[model samples]
Target: MSLLVCESFLSIQGESSFAGRPCAFVRLTGCNLRCRWCDTTYAQEGGGTARSLDDVVAEVRASGLRLAEITGGEPLLQAETPELAARLAGLGLTVLVETNGSLDISVLPPEAVAIVDMKGPSSGEAERMDLANLARLRARDEVKFVLAGRADYQHMRELLPRIDTARNTVNVSPLFGALAPAELAAWMLADRLDARLNLQLHKLIWPPDARGV
Candidate 1:
């Protein structure tokens, strides 16, 4: 089957526990929700280029990186995503699938780590998030919260108890240029929150607007 692919490239993983690692990225197109601070607005529409699953896998293999991430507009929006994840895993690569926490992550292969972006109140799409996915998280899976301000941070704090951090990794990411990292860090430290402070390393390494990093 063919997938609607936006662009594929090699870069350092900028989020999750795998951050700072060399990785290949397969960015699919078309997101179901539109967050106010969404960075990849370009990938949300236009139905991107269609590529066969095998072709996509070959690109990652040729990258020579052992890490691969299937991200999107919303990767789960495509039907063949699980098969693609399975194929990449079959290649002996550590595959990570980043989803916008609106769909059932159970559809992803067990070999693929699921990085579920849990929308906060500031995103305006928080209501679209499927709380059920929190219970569905696998040990290798991760949950991320991108906060735009204190309201978002508060919202994330309310949901933390529902997630089992001992089993899954929880990431608290401040929306680039929207929230101060130090302020968020102070809040987390004061609360003794059991989550990692994840920053978009690519944006720091390069221009925030630069694509194909």
Candidate 2:
């Protein structure tokens, strides 16, 4: 099976626990949720290259980056995502999937690290997050929240104790340009929220609107 891919490129992993690491990114097309502050609105639709699983894996293998991230406009929208993720993992690379947390990740391969985008208030899609996915997490899985303001941060803080804090990596990222990274850091320092703050490392290295890494 193949996927409608927005673009596949090599860049430093920008979010989650893998920030700043060299990684290959496979950004698929289409999403089920439309968050108001979504940064990748371009990925929401339009032209994409439809590539077979072999071709996708070949592209990642050619990048010379051992860490690969399968991101979206919700990659799970593509039914064959599990196969693609498993294929990438089979190639001896550390495969990570950045998902919108609304899908059933229980079927994802064990070798793939799942990064659930746990939407907080700022993202209009907050209510869509399937809380059950939290129970499916393994030590390799991570839950990330992109905060646009104080309300979003506080909402995430309220959710911490209920999450699988021991087995899961809870990451809190201030919406790249929406919230002041320093301010978010200070809040984390004050309340002692046990979540890792993520910055868009790729945006720091290149234009936020630029594509193809």
Candidate 3:
């Protein structure tokens, strides 16, 4: 099956533990949710190149990168994403799928590390997270929360007791320009929250508005 791919390129990873590493990315098109703070709104539209699964995998292979990511407009929105993920992993690349926690992630290959972004209070889509997927989270998976304010941080505090933070990497980041990382860090220290502070390294290196970074 062919996938509607928004963009694909090899660039330095700007987020997660793999930040600063060169990675190939396949940005698929389409999304079901409209998160207010979405950065890749351009991906939500229908205009994109239609690439077959094999073709997409070929691109990654040609890049000669050890790391590759399938991002979105919610990559899982397309039925072929799991197959694309498996093929990428089959090539010995460390496959990462940057996903919103609203779809069924079990479809992805076990070799791919799933970075599930769990919506926080200010995203307006917090309730849309699929609890079933959250329950299936393994230690290999990562969960992220982009906090927008003190209210979001408080909500995260309430959510911590329900999660197995020791088994997985819990990532928290400020909502880009809405809040400061230092504020979130201070709150984490005061509450003794077990989480790693996440920053958009790509945004720091390039203008936040830059594309294909």
Candidate 4:
């Protein structure tokens, strides 16, 4: 089977607990939701190569990286994603699938580390998030909330207590250029929220717009 691949390249993981790690990223094409602050809007459509699973795996291996991330416009929208994840894992690469939390996370390979993007109020797609994904999250998995301001932070704050975070990691990232990092840091500190504050490390290390890093 083949996957509609937007772009595949090696770069430092920009967010989540795995940030700063060298990773091979497979950015898939198309998305069902439109968020106002989306940085990868170009990935929405019209710019992808239909690649066979074997070709995708070969490119990841050629990157000389052990960690491979299947990201998107929305990876789960592709039916072959689970097979792709299993194939990469079969090759001994740790697979991380970054998905917007609108689909079923349980459908992915059990060995694949899922990074679920839980949309916050400012994203406009917050209501579209599938809350059930939080229940499927495991110790190796992560749930991220990108906050745009105090209201979004407060919304996430309230949403946290209902989530069983004992097994999974929680990541709170301030929307780039929209929310100040220090502001979010201070809010988390005062609230004593048990979540990691993640910066888009790749953006800091390289220009934010630079692709295929």
Q: Give per-residue CA lDDT, model 1, range 80-150, as digits (tens).
A: 99999999999999999999999999999899999999999888999999999999999899999999999
Candidate 2 error regions (>4 Å) = none
lDDT of 3 by residue, 81-138 (tens): 9899888888888888999999988988888899988888788988998867767776
Over all chains combined, what TM-score does candidate 4 have? 0.97
Q: What is the TM-score of each candidate against the true structure?
A: 0.99, 0.96, 0.96, 0.97
Which lDDT tens digits does candidate 2 get at residues 1-213? 789999888878888888878999999999999989887888988778899999999989998888999998999889989999999899899999999989989879999999999898888888998988888887799999888998998788777877877678888878878899999999999987777878877888899888877
Candidate-wise lDDT, in order = 0.94, 0.88, 0.88, 0.90
lDDT, residue 116, model 4 = 95
TM match of model 1 to true structure? 0.99
RMSD of each: 0.7, 1.2, 1.1, 1.0
- Candidate achieving the largest lDDT: 1
Model 3 vs truth, CA RMSD: 1.1
Question: Which consecutive 10 residues in model 3 have the weakest lDDT in total?
Answer: 130-139
Q: What's the number of clashes in each of the models?
A: 0, 0, 0, 0
Q: What TM-score does candidate 2 get on C-alpha atoms?
A: 0.96
True lDDT of residue 184, candidate 1 = 93
